[model samples]
Target chain A: MSLNVVSLVSVGRHPQSGRARRADQDGRAVELGLKLVAKALSVVHVGDPDDPVLRQYAGMGLPSMTILKQDKSIDAVPILSQFLQQEKIDIVLTGVRAESGESSGMVPYLLAHALGWPVVARVADIVSVKDGEAQVLLALPRGQRRAVSVKLPFIASVDHAAEIARQSAFALGLRASIESVESVGEVDRIRVDWQESVAKSRPKRLKTVKAKTAAERFKAATAKPEGGTGKVMKNETPKEKARAIFDLLLEEKVIR
Target chain B: MSNVSSLGISSLGIVRRDPRKEWIARNRLHPLYHEVINEGLGSVVGPSGLIRKNPHQIGFIGPNGIKRIDRLKGNGADTSNKRHGSAQEVVLPLHVVTTPDFYLVVVPDLVGGRLSSHDKDILGLAHALQGGMEGNGAVVAVCFGDVKETQFDLAGVDRLIHLTGTEFEGFTPEARVAALVQIDTQLAPQHWLFPDSIHGGTDLGSRLAASLGERPATQAWQVIPEKVVCRGAGGSLDIARQTPRIVMVLEECGNAIDETRHEVLPISVDALEIQSAHLIDHGQVAVDPNEIPLAEAEFIVSAGNGIHNWAQYHQTAQALGATEGASRVAVDDGFMPRFRQVGASGTWVTARVYLAVGISGAIQHMQGIGQCEKIIAINTDAGCDMVKRSHLSVIDDSDVILSELMQLAQEYGVNDKPSQENSPEESQNVA
Candidate 1:
């Protein structure tokens, strides 16, 4: 049976330049969807149809994309859920979090709750789909992975561990058609009270000395900071040096 | 005659001064002044019978043969004596909440059955919120599955709800969320704090928030009772909003509690309605070290252009069980894959230990490893930037070090099995 795979796309702000670009995880989601159902993959966006960033995602060999043209103040959850239900999408793919707006990473969960479907988060890959179930790999901390199986009609959030999105082709993106649809969206009321400003860099927590006595305080103040210059082994034999390195590896528990 | 009498008395341990001698010593030009005035004869009792102490006589001779006075009044001496004795364990005061007026619930991501640093930070934030409000508010830590953390009291947990069951173990977010929902109904905490980390905290917290239908503050760095400052727009913009019921906090949001201990009172829910799980977990997959991404790998062995024997470098990395990485120059030379390149231009790595072989660290390469905890550099040039940044540097040829390291790893693997067997034999011999 052919799978109805849909990838949600969003305009991303470059972290360094703060310019409009294709969202990293969303592009990966599209890449994964393309790998799964190549010709049948449908790309959907909830924001402006004229967002030039949308074309960059199309540049990854997409034939066309659908846009539910809406305003920034409106919530995309209701509109996207409605569209997904109407289309009867078997597999819905999205980035773990949007690179714009609140970036709360609640879209998939909220959508899953609304549709009564299970949502797999931080998915590294979908290994296979068989017997109305898909075998998925979830990314864990420190390069670990967990295998899980969820029934179809589920939502999966593509993780950074997934295969990176292919580079965009300018000509292919220009040739792809962008379909625009006017969808009614609810204005987010709770966000009206929020105050937004440029993020300030957080101060690094310094190692504090809670000295009880004057002598202890003096020693704390006079003590040299740790780990400044490294220990260089110049005259040691190769065996000794290798032993030192091996000891550190053992200390770090990197070796089994 | 008086000096002889005084010397006789001095032999009996009575410090009696001869008056005539003191007078002669006071008269500097007297003939016997040199004999009376010795090195330590600085102070003497007056005829009025008052005892006198010489300031010069109190101090001992220094290394330079000059007397040095200790102005600390022997406090330094007492401290030195204490240092030589056994060290004392410092115990912090306990903070108890008898009748909690409210609750600030915290769900820590106890990775590997222990409290991670991120979990401690969130617990700290929970206590800060509890302190900010009026009345006694208890910080409740709801831990799922096995707990190896014994310092929950030190981590500022006033109450603990440890849910240990097979249902709550290993990738069971659905069951865990159900338990949290039950706790919410029971305690009705004022706020819920979770570490905004990838280690199941964010996932569990988000799941709970969705089920509770409460909008949560994600990536919150600064939080107060009245307001919360969260990083939005992919950490570029700060959004200050009214304090929400659920808050997912970033690391370093508040200081970990070190000054006081807590009760760590164990609590439990009456009954939890665990929902049937739709997702089935198959446990963790065994991932090869080489297949792991360079950015996420905890241990990396990176090579550079100085490596002539690429096969040996790969063998060393394999033996060390480390992910392979490469310097930009190595990637440019087509000796390694582009994804293996580590620099500002390539992937930034946050490995715990980074072992660089022959990489004369470029500025970009240094930038990529900025978050690495320990770096070991093996290079011929001791003055290279990599050596300067590394915790341990070996000035030698890369080929020699790599070969030796590989041999050491192989021998260690061989030695481990025998050591385990020998331990049993040695214990039997002792018996």
Candidate 2:
């Protein structure tokens, strides 16, 4: 049986320039969805229907996009969960976290809880789907991966380690039709209490010396700082220099 | 008599002291005083039959080749001796909470069966929160799987709930969350803190928060009893909100507890009836070094324009068991793929050890490798920026170093064959 896949996209802010653009992981989610069921993949957005950034996502070869028209202050969970329940989607894909707003990364879990469906986090790839179960790979730190098999009708959050989204074509994006659905959204009351401000850079933790004795305090104050100048091997033999590099590699445990 | 023994005279046998040598040792102006005295100017028997100590000669040479004096005298001798591995155990005062009015729960990621630095930071934040409130508050750490963390006391865990079973092993988030849910009902903690990390911490925390119906604060850096400051909008804006019951904290949220030890009292949770999980874990997949992405790779060997033999560079990376990386010039020249490029414009690598061969480091390239712990440069020019940034630099021809390194690696691989065989077999078993 053909699987019904839906990818959720969001407006992303560029980390450096703070410009509104296509979100990174959300685009990857769409790419993964396209890879799964290319022809049947449906892209959905929950914000403004007139957003120009929505076209960038559509430019990923989507013929059209469905936008659930809602205001920015609305709680997306209730609205999204309601919309998803009606679609009867076999698989719902989303970014691990949104790049804008709260960026709390709780939408998938909250949606899963509301729908009573299992949600997989940080999925690197969906290896296969067979016998109503999909084998997925989860990304771990240090280039590690965990393989898992989850039943269909589940939610998955795409990781950055997944295949990158294809480039957007301006002409294709302009031709794609945008279907807007009007929906009344409940205003989020809790967010009103939050005070938003420009982020202040955190201070780098300094190495504080906890000396019990006067001599140690003196040593800590007067001792020359470490690791400024590196050892340069100029006239050493090739064997000696190679041995030095090898020893350093071994010390770092990178050559194991 | 003790002074005479310290002066190199045998205590068992009575020996006659030469008057000339004794006079030379006693006389500070005497040129032969240092040579005649076996012990340096520490302490000596004065002419008045009292022990005289030269306060200036109380210390030994420090590691930086400078003379340092210890003011604590003989009391500080063990501090220096501790470096020789016969450490005098310095026991910190224990912090015990007999009656906890409230509980601050911490669920650590504990990567590799040990409390990671991120875990410790959250634990510290839990303690800071505990300190801010009234009455006795205990920081309870809920850990899963095989816990190899022996220093939980040092990490400021007042109470430990270690759950170890086949169900809690591997990627069993469902079973782990079930256990946490049971703890929540039993303890009814005032606050729940988790490390906002990619290593299952955020996943489990969000899952628990969703099930508990608590709107958790994510990426929280500054947290207190009254308020929490968290980063939002991809770290561009900070949102200060009233502290929530569930908080996912960022690294360095608080300083790690170093001064005092905790009880680490073992706690138990009542039996949890875990529902049938929809996800089944098949364990980890073996990824080849070359297949791993440059950003997540722990060790990277990158090439640049100075590399004459492209084949030799690839072979060197293979031998070193490192992910292949290339400079912008190498990618621009079509020697490497675009994804293999390492720079500000390309993939920023967090490799523990970055080996740059023949790359004169550009400003953007240096910025990319800022987080790398150790950088080794093999360049012809000694004055290059890469060489300057490197912790260990070899000013030589790249061709010579690459060939030498390859041979050494081959020999090392042969010697390390026995240990390396286990990894392949383990991967095969997983498959």
TM-score of each: 0.79, 0.77
- Which lDDT tens digits does candidate 2 get at residues A1-256? 9999999999999988889999999999999999999958999999999999999999989999999999999999998999999987999999998999999999999999999999999999999999889999999988878999999889999999899999988888988999999987899999989999999998898889998778678878999856664889999998899999999999888876
True C-alpha contacts between chains kept, each model in order: 0.85, 0.84
Pick the lDDT winner.
2
Docking class of 1: medium
For candidate 2, what is the TM-score? Answer: 0.77
Q: Write the per-residue lDDT of candidate 2 for residues B1-431, one digit (tens) a residue.
A: 11221223345533334556555545667786556443554687899999999876655544344665544322222334224222347788999999899999999999878998989988888898899999899999999988888999999999999888888888898888889889999999999999999888899999999999999999999999999999998899899999999999999878888989999999998887888888999989866676787898999999998899877887777778888888999888877877788999999999999999989999989888988999999999999999888999998999999999999999898233333222232223221
For residue B121, model 1's alpha carbon misses the true position, in angstroms, by 2.0
lDDT of 2 at B59: 53
Off by over 4 Å in 2: A212-214, A227-256, B1-88, B303-309, B326-348, B355-370, B374-431
Give the residue spans of candidate 1 off by over 4 A: A203-209, A227-248, B1-78, B81-87, B291-293, B304-308, B326-348, B356-370, B375-401, B404-431
lDDT of 1 by residue, A1-256 (tens): 9999999988999999999899999999999999999968999999899988999999999999999999999999999999988977789999998889999999998888888888899999999999899999999988889999999989999999899999999999999999999999999999988999999998899988888778778989998866776889999999899889889889988887
For residues B1-431, what per-residue lDDT tens digits would candidate 1 score against the true structure?
12321222345433354666645644668886665544344557778988676775655433234554544322233323233222446578999999899999999989878988888888888888888899999999999998899999999999999998899888998899889999999999999999999998888888888889999999999999999999999889999999999999998888888889999998878877787898999999866776777888999999997799877887678778788888988888777767778999999999999999999899999999999999999999988899988999999999999999999899877233322221222123221
Alpha carbon lDDT at B400, candidate 1: 94
